[model samples]
Target: MANWVRISSRSIGNHIRKRMNQGFIGSAVDINKSSGSSSALHGGRTVCDRNRRYLNSLPWNRATLFWFQRFKSTVAEKQQDSFLSSDTDDDQLSLDFPGGKVSYTSDMNFISESSQTRVPCYRVLDDDGELIKDTDFQQVSKEAAVKMYSKMVNLQIMDTIFYEAQRQGRISFYLTSAGEEAINIASAAALTEQDIILPQYREPGVLLWRGFTLQEFADQCFGNKADYGKGRQMPIHYGSKKHNFFTISSPIATQLPQAAGIAYSLKMDNKKACVVSYIGDGGTSEGDFHAGLNFAAVMEAPVIFFCRNNGWAISTNVWEQFRSDGIVVKGRAYGIRSIRVDGNDALAVYTAVSAAREMAVNEQRPILIEALTYRVGHHSTSDDSTKYRQSDEIVYWKNARNPVNRFRNWVQSNGWWSDQQETQLRSSVRKQVIISLIGLDIHNLHFFSDT
Candidate 1:
């Protein structure tokens, strides 16, 4: 029996082979080093330090030391716990060299079933309401942040006032983008006045931010004499020749391909403008969706296909619409760069769209941004979402990720505003909305004959 043992698979196999070769084990074998090293008196000797003054040592002890040194190095090289692996097939023994080089060997048995299969959401703002920024987090200027915040706040206030007017029978109908202010206004903030805005009916925030006055909004809403569409279009289907905002359409996704065409025209003229078109998540299921993405990719057209994924199209939830992941992935299949962002965050939406606009203008590539969000209000004044969507779902969107409230929080957190200031701002907006609504009542205005 040995006092200390060094066991190796190779050593065990060699010992077994040697035992078969010999008839019997020797009673004792005296060891001697080839060099003039120590030989102990007793056949079984205690190992001594090699570096000691006794220069001579036992050959067997020297051999044992050499074997162990090699064995320890080999074991250390292969030692890695497989329990912590993110991938099951990997053995997890990784060599971290001086320069950041890594190597891996696959061992299927070491893989675990508990590995994460889905990507966690990438966002700067955490669920706990903390601001997190990193190099990967897209950064925009503070000036842009404040301006975007102001526009979103204004749009939200306007949406509430106008929707309430519709409920009170003061107006025929109105579309409220209550939870969509960040997606609508921040994306508009990302664009230039020269760029074309192909808006779906719910995105009045774009027009309002681009200097469409309250009076102009009222005129369009009322279909009065001052209306830009000359009372030919219905309320809120506003557009401007000078402002570069395209007229809003009633058909589901008509503006999508129209945006591609407009983008093609911009390329034809070698203009600096890029076209941005907004649509609902449900709109991406339409034929126009495929045509728009394909046409833009083929032409290398400068268009930003913005999808506001507000979780519902009329009474239908997003789960009922498609089974093939989100809308952003669909855009990627078209050979267009696509991004998905927290549409509740104005800063995130603005930064994303601004970068997309830059890529569209500089690289001449069409891009798509699917803004993951929810609409707390009805799909439109004519439809009721409460019929299908859970009341709690609407409440979740209204309280949790409310675009208006998020911007307000960002505003206050940054010392850009106070609660008193916010109250005053809301009060001012309400007063202005009332004035604009009252001014729209005109006895001299003629009615539209067109159906």
Candidate 2:
């Protein structure tokens, strides 16, 4: 080591020397099988078995072809633009230098003010409930599709009632996964319940789909004796060790690194499970997101970082999130595999996450997913959307682009669901909420019986 100056001279030469003198930090995972024995037991399934199970559940089954036959014929009369286009474009920054012609440069950004290409958002269906992607559609079985739709609807209904319960002073606080039902349930549907899930506050639907009861949700929110946390945590923060779902934390992006560490531990144990960590577009702004992603990539942690880019961080628009390309680009920076999915499309999210799960565990690599969606409701009860954004903007996403309704139309088109099913499901959900909320007094519940 030598004496180094903290300040540098004012010149490009000094800047170059300064950068070179700085120590380079690295986070990389050595992709190797761990030798240590794992005493912990997983779901009694081998890696190959789980892979086969996942592949079999994909849209490649016989039902997919038959369903598309009827779906295509009905839509043949309609004229629409093709949906199967390349996800990227050829856009380069060229410069005429004194020596010769030069095209892209890593050291210098030739085009500063304008973007070279648009970040592609992956989608399976158009808003009109048509298969827009030219590639063979990823299809779920009719049963699976119907199940996914029901869960999506269930999540929406839960948010509505719980949110109202908060407004009526039944609960101290709440956060609605309103516009994000697809991100919550669809991704959860794609994953095995044994795979660990570390979530921020907005992903309660993951627990709901993993057999967490409606009464449990109410109990946690109301801090009753039945709550796993025993009423010590703030409302809406829930977790279950049995379900392998980690409790929600109010701190943004803190779960990312934790997921990476857990995945690394799973790798050491040679377990076939991967870790999936979820964060919002706003959470990406946190420093933990960077550290977690870099560590996961460098350490070869089998983690999938699911970022729900809902276009707002509290009142801050995504425009304020960052100047660079969206969150997907950050994955590239960390040397991790990444994708951009249509967050509002249940099938698209499910397909993407399912595939990501395979790649993460089998290949022993960290993956990132940037889901494009909008926040349809206020951030939480503490927030008011009208103060920072326009009502029309919210209405557009909430109505025309509601994820629940969009997927419902697709499933119903195949005759898997109908009005009667919808009515019955909604009624059942309402009754569940009523039972959960009314059984015990708001305060002095069993949780309060102790000191």
Error of 1 at 81 (Å): 43
Candidate 2 weakest ten by summed lDDT? 23-32
lDDT of 2 by residue, 212-299 (tens): 9888999999998988899999999999999999998888889998998899778755799899999999999899999999998777
Candidate 1 on 1-451: residue-level lDDT in tens? 5455434467544543243223122222223345423334445553222332332333343335333211111111222223222343343555555533355666546644233442233355643335775625456566776677777777776777777777777779888888888888888887899999998887888888899888788888888888888888887898998889888878989898899988977875579989999999989889998999998886778899998988888877788999756787787567788888888877778788888999898778789898888888887789888788788988987887777777667666777768787777766666666678764333422221110
TM-score of each: 0.70, 0.73
Candidate 2 segments whose C-alpha is farther than 4 A from its true place? 1-115, 440-451
- Which of the numbered candidates is closest to the native, going by highest TM-score? 2
Off by over 4 Å in 1: 1-122, 127-129, 133-135, 138-142, 440-451
- RMSD to the true structure for each prediction, in A, is 25.8, 16.8
Task: State candidate 2's TM-score.
Answer: 0.73
lDDT of each: 0.72, 0.76
